[model samples]
Target: MARVLIAPADTRLSNLRYGKSYNVLNNMTADDVTIDALVGEEETAVEAQNVHVRELGTQNRLQYYGRSFRTAAREIRAGSVDIYHHMNLSYRWFNPVLLAGIAADTPTVLGPCQTGHAIMAEEFNNMLSQAVGYELPLPVSNAVYYPMNAVRDVTIDPVRMSLFRRTLEAADRITVVHEEAREAYARHVDESKIDVIPLGVDAELFEFTERQDTQTLVAIGRLEQRKGYDVLLDALANVVEAFPNVHLDVFGEGPEEQALREQAASLGVADNVTFHGYVDQSVVRDHLARARAFVHPSRSESFSLVRLEAMAVGCPVVVTETAGAHEMVRDGKEGFVVPTEAAEPIADALLELLSDFELTRAMGARARERVERNYDWRAIGQQYVDLYRSLL
Candidate 1:
């Protein structure tokens, strides 16, 4: 049996959408592999067995790449684990996991790392400018909107790049969620070492329920500018013109809640939109089961687990073309993929689905079937098992 150590930036398992390290640990239950977790002190709870929660002390930020690497290396050296599997190493701060693997002489698998940092930064700025009704010059805009990147370039990026190169050189295998992420990481490492492994959905939990005969559209995600809720709201405003009864239910909370509410009012769709604010997963599943369609207009996404969850629940999805998860859904089969940051195309897609119940139902069924065949956790877990065995 291969005893593997899993290390994630966070272990609380709360970030269900993007932070999938917990999901990997929970699902990889092959008889031939035993798993343990090394998590940061920030994690509130850990359900996995043999979890070692380390206090990262004061230097816990991503900019402190060396500190994080040293801390993880110390823990890895002390453990009897054979293989090291680290999630989300693209954050630049978590480059230490690669060093820890080398220090311990353990075969390492890094990533499912996904980021189009520059693209995301630009989109974020665009959304912010649209929200505030002003645009800054490109250079000034980037510096102002994405101060974190500047900070990273100054403190973390230099060290991170050097360490990342070393880590990629040493890693036995690298996994990415989609081609976009694979392309981004390929600049650093041998493309042959990379494998694309899409994230899985818990099909049983998000089991398909017969759709209710209502015009309610659902969107689930943190209320962030990148989520493009403002764009969705704009689209919904147009959608309501075609189907006046059309309603939108937004699940999740963030700093942009007030701004989104204001946007809904400005668009005159306030009455048609409901802000469900930070609902539990069970509630999210319930919404997916009953809603007419699931719409995500994210400016960028590495992988969309929520989109899969919606698909698993027999709900057709409307996603952005740039979303890495769009790769899982065939346009016009499971759902429609509209151009990013556009409301007209999004509204058009929603109107089409709402107008034809039979078409929507057929798409929903196909979406569920797709999830069963390709995105189930059990099957995804086996892929990890195979990867681990290859390294051994």
Candidate 2:
């Protein structure tokens, strides 16, 4: 069996609910390949033989950039692994992992990395201007933002940019979660080197439950500005006037929680929205199983695993056209894909699904079938195995 070394930002598999590192590693072990992990530190007391943890002491920005690279480089050099798979490559981190791959003469796969969306900056600025009740002069705003965008494109950090280029040039293969992500990474490396391998969902964990009678709409994700919860709230305001009994259940928490609550109150939909902050996976699955539809208005996403999970539980989804997960759902077949940041379209989609029971049920069934055929973890893991063998 081929021994593959997996390097992730966190070694202990902490924060498994929010991230895919644990799921990808846990699922990758198969008959043809064995797995080992090289992590930053031992976050938990429970130990495992295949896992190696190191304390990099990344307390400050300098330490985070320097210490982490050196530690990971040392560990990667020591291991007698055939292939190196580094998860979550970012501007500032994972350079050492790439460097180690170079030193060991091993084939490296860097991946599912996603960059910031260009449209998001514009939409966020527009939203900020509306919230502050003033729009910046076009020339003034352009003058201020043009150079900043230029600099951001060229280099967010000089050292990090240098390392990012090196990693991109050194990688044997680069995998991305979506087409847009592949385009984003192409700006920095050869486009032919990038492949689209989406993140997966554990279908068994999110079994379907028949509940077409519910009027609840579900949204799962952290409360962030880019997530567009405020826009979802705006849509909810419109949705409630048509169906007063309709309720929205938001799961997850972040900086925008308080602001979203206030927005809900201001829109007079506070009573209809429930903020179920950071629930367990079981609770998420249970709500998804019962909810009439899942609505995610995120302005951008690399690949939305939550949407796939919702689909796995036989829940119809209404998401933005730009969302990477929208690729998995056929617009009008599984659910709707509306314009990003537009509340009316979102509200319309949600209302359509909520009002028609049979249509919603059929869509939910299609959603489940789509996930079963395309996003199962076992199938996704085999893709990795095939890629590894091809490289070998």
Candidate 3:
């Protein structure tokens, strides 16, 4: 068996979304270090080797996933682990300091966990290069903070870049959860070393549960411009005009909640759209089980675990073509994918499914089948294990 060390920017052992990366990695294999409790206690125990980081310094905070990498690396090295797997480094400040040691000795693979192809957009790529150098021109915007990019510069400073550059140049392999991201990373780094590995979810946790509810339309994810909740509300305005019983429920929280709420009221759909705010992961299944359908109108996404979760519960998903989830959903077969920016098409797609309950059920069944075969946690976990072993 190959021994691997998993390092996530977040407490992979406990985090609901990103933690899944670690869960898939360590489930049937050996994991050296899993910091910040990204996985729950029950999950950590199931894994063969589990280590936790208790420090809540400025580094390990929600925004500072990169800082934990060094601490994770230090511990992994101490234990003589074979491979270092870093999740979501491209998303935020992944300090170079921790990577320096790994690059120097062990074979390492950094998983680009966000939407894969999103980095290929010119605007996004330019912005990302700036972000890497700590000179991001765009203002920070994420959940729970005024300036989301505030820590970017500080975290990816000169000392950090030195470490990261060395690691990137020395790493034996570079991995992306999404295939598109692997291609994008190739443009910046060595293409020969890049590998595409799809991220996995615990399908059993979000398995389909038949429900009689028909009026509920659920949307879950960060409340940000990228998520296109505003467009969803605008589309809902048109949807409810023809179908009054349609009630849209939004899950998750972000910096754009107020703006989205105001848009909902402006569109005269406030009463029809309920913002669920940020809810516990345990209750997410309840919402998924009861919803009539799942709608994701994100303008951008590397990969959408929420969409995967919704589909796992047999909800017919209506997402935008611009989102990476489009790759996952087989249009007309599993779900629908429309233009990213327009509200008219979004509303049309929702109404189309609403008008035909039988069609929705058929598509939803297909959606569940797709995930069951390809995106389920155990199946996906084995793929990751194979990749880790191959590198060794």
Candidate 4:
């Protein structure tokens, strides 16, 4: 039997994203594999499933005395842990776990990594403008244009040279959630070692629920500019002309809350849109099941988890083609896959769904079936177990 230590940013696995998938992996012990965890600083040890969860460092946000890090180093060096599986699901950009020196000391598996993305300079500038555009009278977007470039300047290259290089050298295997990521890592690492194993969902938890025909549409995720809620609003504004009763439910909250609300009002879709900030998973699933269609207009995404959740619930989705998860959805079969940062295509897709109940239901039924066959965590978790066995 192989021993694996799963490291995620957050120990709690209640949320719909990485949490749900890891939770399932926790209890799954197929193929003579055992699991444990090492987090940064868990204030209080919470209820962990079959795996034991351990905090690495001090409760202090800053590495206090490097106590926890040293502990992790000792643990890995001890060789009791067969595989150091780094789950870099926190945010899209970087993983501090590699820098922790854990992966370098032991055979490691890194990612469902969400890196290797290129945001258009013009679009990123526009997103920045909208985010900080609240009070600045003049357009200050150009003041620090293209954060992607800035990130590459000060962060990506340097980190890849030092920390990422160390992990790549020692990593038994690297998994990316999408083909797009494969291109990104290929620039820095051995291409043969990288594999595309996408993030998975619990189809049973998000079981298919028959939906009713309505003009209602649903969108969830942080209320950030990247989500492209503003574009969804513009689409909603266009959608209201033919169907005045057309409605949109926006879930989750972030820095762009006020900006999104203001955009909705400005677009004259305020009545058509309802901003429901920070709702629970059940609420999100309820709306996904009940609403006519789910729309995720993210400018970029490694993989849109919510879209998979929507599919698991027999809800058709309209998403941007740039999203990694869009590959899982057939353009017209599951739902529409439109161009990123565009509103007309989104509006057009929504219009088609609103006009045709049969199309929505048919797409939704296929979506549910697809998720059951492909996205179930039990099947995906085994992939990790097999990877661990190979590493040993």
Best by TM-score: 1
After superposition on all C-alphas, the RMSD of every candidate to the true structure, in Å, is 5.7, 6.6, 6.4, 5.3
lDDT per prediction? Answer: 0.76, 0.75, 0.67, 0.72
Write model 4 residue lDDT over 357-378, tens digit each, in one string.
9999999999999888777777
Which rank order by lDDT, best down to worst?
1, 2, 4, 3
Using TM-score as the measure, name the better of candidate 1 and candidate 3: 1
Candidate 4's C-alpha lDDT? 0.72
- Give the alpha carbon lDDT tens digit for every residue of 289-390 in model 1: 889999999887767888898999999999997647557889999999899889999999998999889989999999999999988876776688789899
Q: What root-mean-square deviation over C-alphas does model 3 reach?
A: 6.4
298: Cα error in model 4, Å: 1.1
Residue 132 error for model 4, in Å?
A: 22
Off by over 4 Å in 3: 15-18, 30-79, 91-105, 112-166, 211-213
Clashes of each: 1, 0, 15, 1
Candidate 1, poorest ten consecutive residues by summed lDDT: 56-65
- Per-residue lDDT of 95-133 in model 2, one digit per residue for the tens? 556654544487788876776554444454553454344
Q: How close is candidate 2 to the true structure, as a TM-score?
A: 0.81
